[model samples]
Target: MLHSEFYLFEEEKPLRCTVRNYQENDFQELIAIQSECFPPPFPDELWWNVEQLSSHLIHFPEGAICVEVNGELAGSLTCLRISYDPAHPHHTWEEITDNGYISTHDENGNALYVVDISIRPKFRKLGLGKLLMQNAYYVVIELGLDRLLGGGRMPGYKKYAENLSPEEYLKHALSGKLKDPVITFLLRCARTPVTILPHYLEDEESLNHAVLMEWKNPFK
Candidate 1:
């Protein structure tokens, strides 16, 4: 299912790779990685929805990107456009209020929500995660978006071993599925909106925030 993508950024190898303005053409590639990384895997349709939303409402640099390693697609990130709206009072949302994810939203423009990013099995320890993130930081500049936000599940279970490398720890963590805390901490420290909500999965936090974010950052 892996095809050699003739990407414009293929020539650049500064330890980090970027996939700008992702579209339907990138759908299969994205799902390949998403299915590999996420458990219970989100429906394939979600990818289509994201692409539709981005194509319809996403603004400059507020789309998505993928990272390459050794000339192969290693990981991908989707930075979504989001914002706060007066119509929605997230003062009692679950993600912002509960489960402790950031709730802040950008008013003037939109925020970039780091939806998903995963490195292939062979690409760990290459400092790609941090590099991918640093690249996301530059996304704000590219999209002219003031702020970025997203929820990540942290590794609730981790066993650090002297013999194990950092990537080994990360791989263990990823296999254990601990990313929420990572996103929570980053959102808490970053300039994002704060809202209250119940368990993020069942609650309407993402929906509420999406409403606000979409309302402001709708298909441009």
Candidate 2:
């Protein structure tokens, strides 16, 4: 795939950043950014190794993108194409990712599956997350995919797990009555919760649960 350099202008300081495809030299930097974004117990063990990351880049080069700001690796969004069946059962992150290599990726798949997205802590709340999501939308259009699907970890749902069901919590998040750091942002990006996934990941914040979300391609 042909990659292009895109710029983002922050309202306050007008920072110049480029969003582009991953390269061989970016592996270690991506790992470091992932570590800083997701602290310990956030399942760093499940992250991709050099070989695994290489496999993704080889199979679906355009699916993985990195953000550079002031010549620093700031964030990245990794995805894969898969044949989706709404009636088919949903798979866990490990199952779909093949432990991170995305061995099951289907080149002709009509749905784009987001595998992971990470932003450095120092760069959070700077509109980078939304920028990455917008880029994903363009990818869907570029590939002519039907929609983008992913399991969103409910980082704030654990607090009400005993009191409210995942569906109930999602309703609140969708309605703007509740503010969940992750889900709220996804909602703002036009992703709608489709279902609740139990035991999505072994993390305290998610309480082993996630929300299956989708953003249908408007251009499709």
Candidate 3:
């Protein structure tokens, strides 16, 4: 039931939004959200599956969280703990996340690496993405992790690929001369850019590159 007639709910009445850890029953809706958020050309195989979702629950349940509006799933943020190496920080999403299964979750790791954050189409513009991210910050604090990290996509880069190198494009985007959908959003969420990683993922728009960002825990 790819792109099925689901999550098309009315928001006329007052809403009750709650953020909570992932549960076994939430997997189906989570998969549906993935399909809607990342359509074709986004590599269907990269979407979360039962095996990977189950692994999140078994290995790092606290790092898997979802936001619900009026009892319906609106968005989610899945992460894994890792002993991040600042000296050699270059790594692809596949290598870091164990191909999205997060089977390599390090319980005593120094950082919480965000594997994915997806918001439903209808739920956009409601600040759910930032809300999920803020909760991730709490996760870092509660677990005493040093920081939060992610390889952010730059979906807007393809538009300027012919004229600008990835680094140049990022410089412009950072300076407010241009805006990258993923990169800009992360910046607004208080994540600081660390470096640009080539071949970080299979994203065509990002030219297979990603911007590695971090949000250090103030409490650390």
Candidate 4:
């Protein structure tokens, strides 16, 4: 399990921030967060259900956590353990995460695979997403894992799909020629781009493609 409490100063006011494991009571808020973050075209059916959340708490509580700002639930980061092989890292999000149930979590896995990192719309722009990611990194260290891995959506890709291939789009995003909301954020978090994952998810804006990214554990 991972738990941390800290503070963030915004406009000279202190905001109490706490990161803790998911409790059964926070279920409703977690569901609302998905509705606010992923709207139409992003299948509503993909939202987390009680069963998946239950599996997270049961399978790996250390990999499931939420952030609260001033006593309000603000964001969450859900993950699962996996023995990853860099040489053969190709896999869909559903396949790797067992369609978000995370039943595939391996107790002896070498890497922490992040299934999702979501922030409440109103709580965004407050660095909570990054904060959630930082906590996940801590989970990696605490669990003695080798790295953090995830498939990040290139939400800005569809805008250039007619003119650029997914690989070219990723290269441009990495080179700072263009900014992709998800890819850029991952880069800022110090994650290295591995490759483009075509048909990674049913994301229209991402053209169903995601950029596989990883942050090797420095302490490992």
Candidate 5:
């Protein structure tokens, strides 16, 4: 699909931004934005290197996207197609992504697996994350896929990790009682939690756990 045809919906303020596919020239800004979004140890295990980023563009050109606001890289969402089976177990981010290289991308797969979504710290809270997710949903529909899947890190859950399990924290977040800045927004967006993936990442923020979430395409 064309970049102009990807994000069909507009935000309230209509961020004067251009959402498009990743280009080779975007490498430096992309890495800068990623580093700003996740600093220190957080990015140590998550940020993609030059080769990995290049591989994404080469392997899944259409699935990797970025949002440019005022000539600056605001945010990006990287994903790839995968054939999934609900009867079988879901794979961890490392397993599915080949440790972030996206070597496992399957063009003929029926599900869109989100590898990463990063927004510059200054650009966050401006509905960019939701915008990125909406674009992913559009990709799913465009590809005639069944659903979108990914491991959602609960950055806020680390505060309660000593008391609540990831599952319990998810219940509270989904119950509309206690709100998690990330998971709550995702749940509100119609993404359902399937299971808790332990040791999903080395990031200390999520206590190394992540919620496996899925957004089934209602149009399918």
Candidate 6:
């Protein structure tokens, strides 16, 4: 059999990612990649270009990783620190904006608020997701942060919106109610009982689909 034939059945090696600091040049690419991965993707020209600085992807401060395959950019992972309470002295919450509840710590005691990651479909399922998650987890651990939260899931709650029914398409589009059942089903399928937050993410539609898993994080 030719080497090409062997490639058909063999799984590709994981992407080669160089965890490095983001520069000014990497901003547009990041947004473009995000647009590809997410449904309500952020467009490239929207930000006055200078507004790109507000992007957490450019300032992982603690750190970030960009995967490159055969010298081509494949995807990226970002980290941000966020806080809900402004009075908190340790206020490093990236920016006070929507869903800015999660926080990421920077070397300078600043926080980064991250939300999107865009992995090329071809490079997925090869441990990239886990790699990105683990990297983010490490940042929090090294910083000794007790709280780690993100806007949506690892990759924004867009995929769950795909092919949603009209009933599922009510309030919050596909985030709350639709998100719960889908998550619950995934857990059940994994032989784990369906569990969820009591009030999923400030979205009322969540009530119809999720069981009250917990009212609070139980830590705070």
Model 2 ranges off by over 4 Å: none
Decoy 4 TM-score against native? 0.98
Give the clashing pairs for model 4: none
Steric clash pairs (candidate 2): none
lDDT of 3: 0.89
TM values, all candidates:
0.49, 0.94, 0.93, 0.98, 0.91, 0.50
Q: Which stretches of candidate 4 lie over 4 Å from their true place?
A: none
Instruction: Indicate the worst ten consecutive residues by lDDT in candidate 6.
Output: 1-10
Clashes of each: 32, 0, 0, 0, 0, 8
Pitting candidate 1 against candidate 4, the one with the higher lDDT is 4
Decide which is better by lDDT, 5 or 6: 5
Q: What tens digits encode model 4's per-residue C-alpha lDDT throughout 113-171?
A: 99999999888878988888888888888888899999999889999999999999998
Query: Once superposed on the true structure, which residue ranges of model 3 sit more than 4 Å away at CA?
Result: 1-13
lDDT for every model?
0.43, 0.84, 0.89, 0.91, 0.83, 0.40
TM-score of 6: 0.50
Tell me the deviation in Å of residue 12 in model 4.
Answer: 1.6
| Candidate with more favorable, higher lDDT: 2 or 6 | 2
Model 6: CA > 4 A from native: 1-15, 39-50, 53-60, 84-113, 153-220
Candidate 5 per-residue lDDT, tens place, 62-146, comes to: 8889987766788899999999988764568888998888989998998999999899887776778888898999999988999
Q: Write the per-residue lDDT of candidate 1 for residues 135-205, one digit (tens) a residue.
A: 66666665666455444432332233335443343454336544433433343233233332222332121
> Who is ahead in TM-score, 4 or 5?
4
